[model samples]
Each structure stands twice: as structure tokens, then as C-alpha cells.
Target: MTDEATQRLQDAEEHKKSYDGIMGAATEVGVPGALGLTMMFTSLVMANGVLLSILAGVAVYVLSHIIVKMFFSHH
Candidate 1:
């Protein structure tokens, strides 16, 4: 019984590690800007800034592009 419990715990740990690995891979290869744009747009609208919102949106787009490129370049 004790041996079986230990094996179960080890199996759970291995499954967790595998899931993390898969997620890490997906994140590296996934789309870059949907969430960031959503957040930036929401904030801009909430704050009600015109010029600042434009600048913020542009900055987020550019930064997201650069970051995604840097990560996906290696793979």
C-alpha cells in the first residue's frame, strides 16, 4: 500500500511537469497581442484620453511584435 501511494505521487509529479512543458511551448509559439491590446484599449477608454490612448496603443503593438519575434526566433 505504501509503495503504491509513492508511485501515485511520482506519477502525479511527472504529469504536472509534462503539462507545464506543453504550456511553455504553446506560450512561446502563440499570438502575441490580443490580451495586451484589450487591456490597453480598456484602460484608454476608461481614462478617456485621446492622444495618450493613441500613443499607448501604438506602443503596445510595437512592443508585442518585438517580444514575440524575440521569443519565436530561437524556435
Candidate 2:
């Protein structure tokens, strides 16, 4: 391969590695934080019942993971 092609490939690999590291870090911190926030929000907002609140909290947690993954996975 030419010098420019090799350089571009190296740059792409570096970028991918950086992105993976960032996503890994985000997952490490974001999950527990999201769970805690979901619990808090559910408790405060859905005072009507326990089951519904727990369900809402789970939904929030799942949504947070999805959002984080989608945001980080894309360029």
C-alpha cells in the first residue's frame, strides 16, 4: 500500500480504538448511575404503587443503555 493509504488505515484504527475505550468507560459509569436515577425518579414521580414504579425504573434503565450505545456507536 501507498504511504497515504497506510496512514489513513492507521488513523481509522486509532479512532476505532479510542471510540471503544470511551464507550467502555461510559458503560462502566453510566449503568449504575442510570439505575440509581431511575429508582429515584420512579419513587418520586410514581407514588401510586410499587410495581408500576419498578417497571418504570427498569424501562428508564433500558432506555438509558440504548441511548448511550446508540450515541457512541455512530460516527
Candidate 3:
């Protein structure tokens, strides 16, 4: 094969590998981290009673989970 063709193939493989790595990392860490951050932010920003904050956080967490599942469900 020509050098140019070989270079293109190598670039494609590298791109795929990087893409897969990013996706795996996102799945393993990104989702839960984002959820936690969101819950914390909601609770803190509400600045209401502690019980109310906790309930609001739980509600936000559940609602977010449902929304994410509905939108991003696999097959």
C-alpha cells in the first residue's frame, strides 16, 4: 500500500481508539458525577429548610434519571 494510504488507516484507528476511551470514561465516571453535582447544586441553591432541600434534591435526582433513561435508552 502507498505511504499515504497507510497513514490514513493509522489515523483512523487512533481516532477510533480515542473515541472509545472517551466514551468508556464518560460512562464510568461522568454520569454519576454529574448527577451528584446537580443534586448538590439544587439543594444548596434552594436555601430552604434542610428537610425541604433534601426532598428537592431527591426529586431532582429521580426526575433527571427518568429523563436521561427515556432520552438515551439503548435499544
Candidate 4:
């Protein structure tokens, strides 16, 4: 009984670890993609000139860069 409980806890911990890893990876990519798409859509709708388009592109790039840095994996 004690051994079974220990094994169950170990299994649960393993599952949780894998779940966290998957979610971490998903966020690292999904967040940037979502942000970039939103920026692009808004830029398309709001930008009416070359200068505004250029500014929107820069804004998208900077925001994506910041998100990547924050979510970057070291391992």
C-alpha cells in the first residue's frame, strides 16, 4: 500500500512536469505568433501611408522581440 502510494505520487509528478514543459513551449511560440498577427491586422486596418506602415512594422518587430526575450529558453 505504501509502495503503491509512492509510485502514484511519482507518476503524478512526472505528468505534471511534462505538462509544464509542453505549456512552456506552447506559450513561447503561441504568444509571439498571436501578438504578431494582432499587430499586423491592426496595422493593415489603420495604416494608410508608407510612414504609418513603416512605423507599424517597427512596432510589431519590437513587441515580438521583447516577448521572445522574456520567453526564451536557456536549456
Q: Looking at model 2, report the run of 10 residues with the lowest lDDT sum.
A: 28-37
Question: Candidate 1 versus the native: TM-score?
Answer: 0.47
Model 2 ranges off by over 4 Å: 46-75
lDDT (tens digit, per residue) of candidate 2 on 1-75? 699999999999999999888879768567746785768576867575777677767777777777777776755
Q: For model 4, how does the per-residue alpha-carbon lDDT over 1-75 read when each residue is reduced to its tens digit?
A: 999999999999999999988877666656666666666667768756656755676677677767676756554
| TM-score-superior candidate, 2 or 4 | 4
- The lDDT per prediction is 0.70, 0.75, 0.71, 0.72
Give a tens-digit lDDT track for model 3, residues 1-75. 699999999999999999978876665456645775677677778777677766666676666666655665673
Residue 63 in model 2: lDDT: 74
Clashing pairs in 2: none
Candidate 1: give the clashing pairs: none
Model 2 scores a TM of 0.50
By the TM-score metric, which is better: model 1 or model 2? 2
Per-residue lDDT for 1-75 in model 1, tens only? 999999999999999999878866555433435645665687687895867776676677677767866865774
TM-score of predicted structure 3: 0.53
